[model samples]
Target chain A: MLNNKEYLNKLYQSDKPLIIYKTDKGYDIYTDFSRRIIINKKNLKYFLNIQTKSKKSKIEELNCYVGFFGYKLLCENIGIKFPKQRSKNFHSGVFYKPQTKISIGKKIIIKSIKPDFRNISINTKKYLQLNKKFNLNLSLKQYSKIFNDFSKNIKQGKTYQIKIAQTYSKKGNINSIDLFWKLMKMNESPESFLIREKDYNIVSCSPETLILKKDKTIRTKPIAGTLRKTKQLNKNKALTFFRRNEKETKEHNMIVDMERNDLSKICKTGSVKIDKLKKVEEYRDLFHYVTTIKGVIKNKMSNHDIISSLMPGGSVIGCPKISTIQLLNRKEKFDRNIYTGSFGIIHSNGDMRFNIMIRTLLNFKNDIELSVASGVILGSTAKKEYNENYIKAKSLLDLFN
Target chain B: MIYLIDHEDSFTYNLAHLLDSIEPTFVSNYYEIDQIKLEKSSTIVLSPGPGEPKDYPLTTKIYNKYKGKKKILGICLGFQQIVFCEGAKIVQQKNILHGYQSHIKVTNDKSIFKKNFNFLGGRYHSLKMAEPFVSQSMIITMRCVKTNVAMAVEDDINKVYGLQFHPDSFLTPHGKYLIKKILSR
Candidate 1:
């Protein structure tokens, strides 16, 4: 019998598309998919309307499609049209129906249509590292100009809050699986995952859950405020700081209300309520203020309806999802690709879970890109927000060191 | 039917949900003001949106044309619109309060806000009707306890009302009751 790392190495060496999603217990490894669907601007709406075909499977996790929706597709779905901008022309979205699954937790469980026990020697000694330094797409001066413009918009009442994206890129080649494990060891987040495909790869340490639907209950955990962690600052102190700081509290309040409004659209009347109020979540280099809001799903609400109502989540996009998105798209010179998009699974039984794709690295054609953003409100300063963005990208950049 | 004039704001749906609980509500973008079936709607709600009153000319037109004929209510930007259309100078507030909860005190005892008396409301705006709103028909119904800015206004005889704070926010516990009171009138 092979060990957990050996089993993962075997799957990674199989050259088949795979996804290793982190769960509360351990990791769920899916490989050898039976079918794949690639979505674009033309077929997005058509695919959204199509229901997931139910299959006879005793394993609940196996009867689902695992994939990601890109940021552009999400914007298009919500009737937001972007002006012509430079883009890498990435696929809008993709999903896979897996045939083999392995659950790694207290006990190793394997379920597959055709189980493959064949294994080769696994080398767990190598550490992955990037060969080049990552360069930010925007300079401080340029970011200041854009921040001033956004401030003007806020003053003019065009938008209350907006999140601006900045990309850090470099040319490098490293084993994605190794990188995922290394990053996991450094900063393991709840919504983290690793995807290895033929043409591209994605490794995410996303901390925000955009949607988690189980039966009739739907919940979203929106993260709004962030504080850089120091040796003196602890979780309790961070919570006090968030509560006492008027700017952080206001930003958090706006996002909470916006998320509630989003849930109210597809939820039963008066069913939406805050399950967890402003709480502090400790990460490696920062502390985040997060709130969990849940609602009872309205009857006859389809998966499409739920996705449309919650995709490109408000916390990442800022308050007033539609107009803020428009402002961000207009100001951003490049495509967001999958930065703020969602990644998770949609089960055949209509149960689904997705996370906002922040603090993620996208590797395509030997070029790797990591995107991070911070929310700007009325009282936010350009220098503070810019440094905050760097703090968000630090853990990922630290991997190279 | 309560016609909600959406100014392309994020909280419009929450407002719609609030109004729907009182009566069947229909939502239309502010640009579609001319197409609204004026005779069918019992009330007109100018939703909280993202801009100055001067940006939405059609809403101003609708308010001017039907101020006394229909029950009109405004929120945030909508509140500024009501005052701006009534000859009050809309100026930038010294302290912009967005998503800040403020203690509200009802100034006019006979208006609809008399029921709630004083309460906390979620405010999201950067502009306010300049102080000393010298208007003949409009009366300040509520003021923020901290800033003393006009939080609400009413023209009882004209059946027009405005609220500078957002009643549809989760932060405002009395949002439902306040909307109900406005609809009752």
Candidate 2:
């Protein structure tokens, strides 16, 4: 394990953002102004003094990373195909394309990132020590923005989820906001993140993959049923209705069927397995019907092929893939550049990880854009969709005005 | 120009309806720094969305980039974001609060000169902080109607500010004033 804090200190000390990223169950790479280090699932390879492209920013850049949990896969499967490797070069690994140069405007001095430490665990002691480096004081009032939008979108029938997440823990005392943002940017992983500390800014500027790798380990947690809080309400009945509601059950079944068929694409015949179905998990605001699908990839399938097969997750696109995508095409009035897309990175080794940029922000030069959308089903009402968008817009709306 | 952070059809249309007088621009959340050249025209707003601050770093970057150069307003996460961007901590709450009439108490009138705190109510369901804290330069302008948690905070911190409550929300009263007060500045 590397002292990520010390590494972060080094990046900060030099005022350069380092790019650190990893492939699932494989290798992790860290590129920066000083060095470009690659850490495989086993050995660590150092590639210093690498080549750079003619175009580059003269300023320093830093980015770092900590492994993301598998729960991340559920978010990306929103409107794309399920259980797919996001990056094209995962199997072959190692993508060193046109790099950026930090020049003084005269002689072009090329620079390449270095490779370092290989073995790292989600629960490593050294990782934990390094994780404490950048402790942020996070405000708690944003969830209401989610609720407000949820109410509005629900009324409009734009079906989407309101997920409130917190950094329960940081594995590597890695505290570089710039580094974390940059690492996910590498490979421009669609599900990767870049949140700035100075402005509490965040960006899903990933152009790579958005879901988990291998396409074998697949997941689908379709949401259904919601509880409207009222002064006069029956708790037990509400619980019973939520637990076994009819309408909710139908929505749940539709998604389950939708997911099963998707799994059949990458899985062997009869290999699709249901780990859990209709599991109701209660959150601060509402409840959701979560189902888990597990399957092994067919022996002769390439990750990219599987990726093309499942470009947009079904969660965002709706049940019947074609019809649902078409419905969204007609109903959705906004251009979803990367909001519903994905972003993540592929390392030298084949290990990969990614997420859905649902709660993503588009940062252009003069404009700071925040985007969010939801799935609209056949049973969805216009009011419901509107409320869902409202719920969805809670955080960004709060941040904007 | 009414600068909104969200790109919903009505977010533009309805905003246009509310101010049927102005042609507001509903911006999208996907751009590099050079794309968001939001230099002084009038109002700039950071909109709402899913995910936490860590997900959309660019919005914050853009805000800080134009902090002193423009008159800005943050709604929902945009609200919390401005405070956090100016150096406050954004932590998740235990119990999420949402819906209309979720207004807070305005302890001070630093940015906007408002009187009644009860009239400041807006529709919302969020997880907020206990102490309404801000950077030394910022002043806590308003709070939750009931909890009194910091609902709005601003200060001499580079003419930039934020509101935890929703002003564009159809539910809020005098949202037009709230938006204009910041934009007009």
Candidate 3:
């Protein structure tokens, strides 16, 4: 029997970041770092060649690795040259190999042998108190203008769609682990993750999958449209309204089509198919219209090619991805850092899964930063889109309340 | 009765709303047409959707079933399919129109939709009719004033109508009336 409580206490104080990814039915905890892979200008080649090394290290019984890829990796993977965009508070991307991998499910599986657990119950009442007031880098008016500009671009056919994002920040010294555990208990999602890196801790309750590679198949669940959950709103009415909403449907369909195009590049010819379209997923305080696209990995295509083909997740960037990303870089106030970036493990068996970081809170020393974005198309209104940003961030912020 | 073939387009829900009087039964492109009871419905609607019309072979099959039997109105991509099925061609436009409003003039007012008045229409399409008319028998009902592109077409004999513009979208003024005209026929 492993000492789960003792390990949690050690993880709460560990200097190295830990990754906690909840699988479909259970939790997979990655910690006790051993190897490091930093994606930078110098080691870009080695970083892209990670799949071969991972495959070589594969053991049939136990396989686990965890880290994050920043949004900037998209530019590098796609071979688009860009000037070094300044990172505001966090490192863009890095991967870490954990010495110990723990899987808690029907049967507890602990990789790497070392284990400890103290039979102590944590007081659930002890919670982290955070400032409710948030500081926005871009004013509401400025955000509206940016949204309008993107809409104009859509009208002119410069780009079909662009996602507008803004960062909400608050300064405080809070317990990151407590906040994460509170969120884990309060909100349940398919891709809920808690990532702790050197100075920054990422606590995300994301519901979208950037990419999931299982054997020869690659799948992604892109979540585009959103509806705020409310007690007064009838579930049926909301579902019907979401289905019929023109802007919401258009935004979602555009992402789905774009994702299909992205996957087709690395996937075998005629293997890409939309498994699901605009299915509404209900969360604690938000409703997301999700779509699943699946494709068979081409035998000749390396993992590098697959990641390059679909990085930064199409839905987060927008349709006509390249130009839209350039436009976003210019319009948004700060770099995305690890938000909208993905974090997961590449198993030794050539399997991996990464989640899109929405509804996430990141701690950078003195500041707690949270970002939310929405797709802006031709008919998008600034006021409604502004409200949507808040709606997407509400679940994460509610943990503070 | 209205049989709405949902191509997973955002406009399908709105099109369904416009035809609420008929209580349109919605079926996706994935659904097999042979299994559906299309004979019970008097009208068939092909909902607007993304991608090339030829990509959805199911839609072309659905169009064949209701060709001359049921009164059909094809919207956007559906409109492209009706033209393609009728031996016409659809090509990608140099510039795609998405969520744009345009003024359309009624070219052939003598047809069933006898409104000589110019009206606003909503457009969301990347593919346009390469040839304006499907065949010599088809009438060019409405054309955009700015681009001179065919916005609406009809074949009285086959009872198949096509609208390149979205008349069900709220952006298009008096869209419900157009839906009424198509259904009443």
Write down the lDDT that model 3 would get: 0.72
At residue A26, candidate 3 shows an lDDT of 85
The order of the candidates by lDDT, greatest first, is 1, 3, 2
Model 3 CA lDDT for position A276: 79
Q: Stretches of candidate 2 above 4 Å error?
A: A1-192, A195-241, A281-287, A331-333, A347-351, A378-380, A399-401, B1-185
Report the C-alpha lDDT of model 1 over A11-122, residue by residue, as the tens digit.
7666567799999999888877888889776776565556364665666667888999999999898889989988988878998888778888988787777556444444
Q: For every candidate, how close is chain A to the native chain A in TM-score? A: 0.94, 0.51, 0.89
Worst 10 residues of 2 chain A by lDDT: A41-50
Question: lDDT winner among the candidates?
Answer: 1
Cα shift from native, residue B122, model 3 (Å): 14
Candidate 2 local lDDT, A1-401, one digit each (tens): 43544443443334233233333332233333233222221221121111221223332321212222112222233332223322112111112221332221233232334333222222221212333322211222433444354444433223222222211112222233443434333323323454322212234432223345443554433344455434454555555775565445444544554455455555554455567755554432333456666566677765444443344555555433443343334322333434444434433233334555454553322224445444333344444554555554343333322
Error of 2 at A227 (Å): 6.0
Q: Give a tens-digit lDDT track for model 3, residues A1-401.
A: 32665655655664545677888768877766666677664565565555324542343433455777777765666655555555664665777766666676886566653333222233332223367687877777998889888766665444667788888888765566667778878787888888766666788888888889989998999887888877876667677977788778767656765676567666665577679766778888877788898988878987677777678787787756666676777776577777787777776666778887777788877678888888776566788888888888887878766
**For this target, which candidate reaches the highest DockQ against the unseen true structure?**
1
Better of 1 and 3 by DockQ: 1
Which ranges of candidate 1 are over 4 A from the true structure?
A1-6, A56-59, A115-131, B32-38
